[model samples]
Target: MYIILFNLLSWVTFFVFLFVLYLLILWMWGNMTAKVPFVGVPSKVLHEIEKALDINDDSVVYDLGCGDGKVLFYLYKKNPKATYIGIENSSFPTILAKTRNWWHKKFNTSKIEIIKKDFFEVDLSNATHIFTYLYPSLMDDLLPKLDKELKSGTKLVSASFHFTTKKEIKEIDLKRGRYQLTNKIYVYEF
Candidate 1:
C-alpha cells in the first residue's frame, strides 16, 4: 500500500510540474506574439452585460481575442440557439478554446466556432452582437474596423475599455468586491 501511494504521489507531482511548465511556455509565447495576455472577464461583469444585452436566440455573437472561450460559453449557456464565434490569436488559449468548442459540439450541439487567427483578419459583417475585453490601444484600432464591417444596429459590448466613438448607448460599472477593483462594460449600437 505504501509503495502504491508513493507511485501515485510521484505521478501527481510529475503531472503538476508538466502543467506548470506548459503554462510558463504559454505565458512566454503570449508575451512574444500577442499584444495582450490572456485575461478573462470577471463573472460579475459578464453577468451584468448578459442582463443588459438580453441576447436573442437568432443573434450572431463574436468574441474577439476570446481566451479559453469563457464569454462564449457563458453566452451559449444563456442562449444556446445563438451562434458564437471566438477569434483567438494566441496558440495556447486558442487550443484550449477549440477543445472546449469540440466538447460543446459533441454535447450541447450548438453553432460555436473557435478560430486560431488574428481578430483583425476576420470579417464582422454578419455579427449581430460583438464582445471584447481588449486594451485601450487595440480598442482604438478596432473601432474603425468594426464601423466599416458591421452593419448598422449591431450591438457591441466592451469590457474595461471604452471606445472614443459616439455610438455608446449605455455603460454599467460593477465592483469585484476585492482588490478595490471596479470594471465597466460599455454598450454601443452601430
Candidate 2:
C-alpha cells in the first residue's frame, strides 16, 4: 500500500510539472507573438489615468493591448456607469483577463468585456476614451488607425510611450520623491 501510494504521488508530481511547463511555454509564445509582455498598469499610474480622463455614464472606454485587464477593471470600479472594453491578442493574458472579469462580476453590477482579438482589427469609433501601455513603434503604427477611426473629442491616455506624430495635451510625470520615472503618462485629444 505504501509503495502504491508513493508511485501515485510521483506520477501526480510529474504530471503537475509537465502542465506547469506547458503553461510557461504558452505564455512565452503569446508574449513573443503579441510583441508586448503582460505588464499591468501600476496602481500609481492608474490613479494618474483616472485623473487624466473624464469618465461618465455615456463613456465607452477601450484599453488596447489590455493584458490581464487591470486597467479596465480599475476604471470600471471607479465609474461603474461607463462601459469598459479590453482588447488583448495574447491567449494567456486574455484568459487571465476573462477569469478576472468573471470573478469581478460576482460583486459588481457592471461587467468589463474582454475580447481576445488584435486591437487593429477592432473598431475604435465607439470608444470615447482609450488607454494603452505599448512601445514607441507600436504607438507610431497605431496612430494612423486612431486618426482614421477615433472620432473627434475622444481622449487617449497612454502610459510609458507616446505617439511621436502627435502632441499630447497633457503629460504627467510619475515620480518617486525627487527621482522622476523614465516613462510618463500622456493624454491626447482627437
Highest lDDT scorer: 2
User: Candidate 2 residues 1-190, lDDT tens each?
Assistant: 9999999999999999998888788799987876778877767677788878878889999999999888888888789999999999888888889989998888887758999999999989999999988988999999999999999999999987888889999998876545534258899999
Query: TM-score for all predictions?
Result: 0.85, 0.87
Mark the regions of model 2 whose C-alpha exceeds 4 Å error after superposition. Answer: 1-16, 177-182
lDDT of each: 0.86, 0.88
Over 1-190, each residue of candidate 1 has an lDDT whose tens digit, in order, gives 9999999999999999999899789868896877878878877666787876678988999999999999999989989999999999997888789988888788878888999889899999999999988888999899889889999989988887888755579888675555633367788898
Best by TM-score: 2
What is residue 14's positional error in candidate 2, in angstroms?
5.1
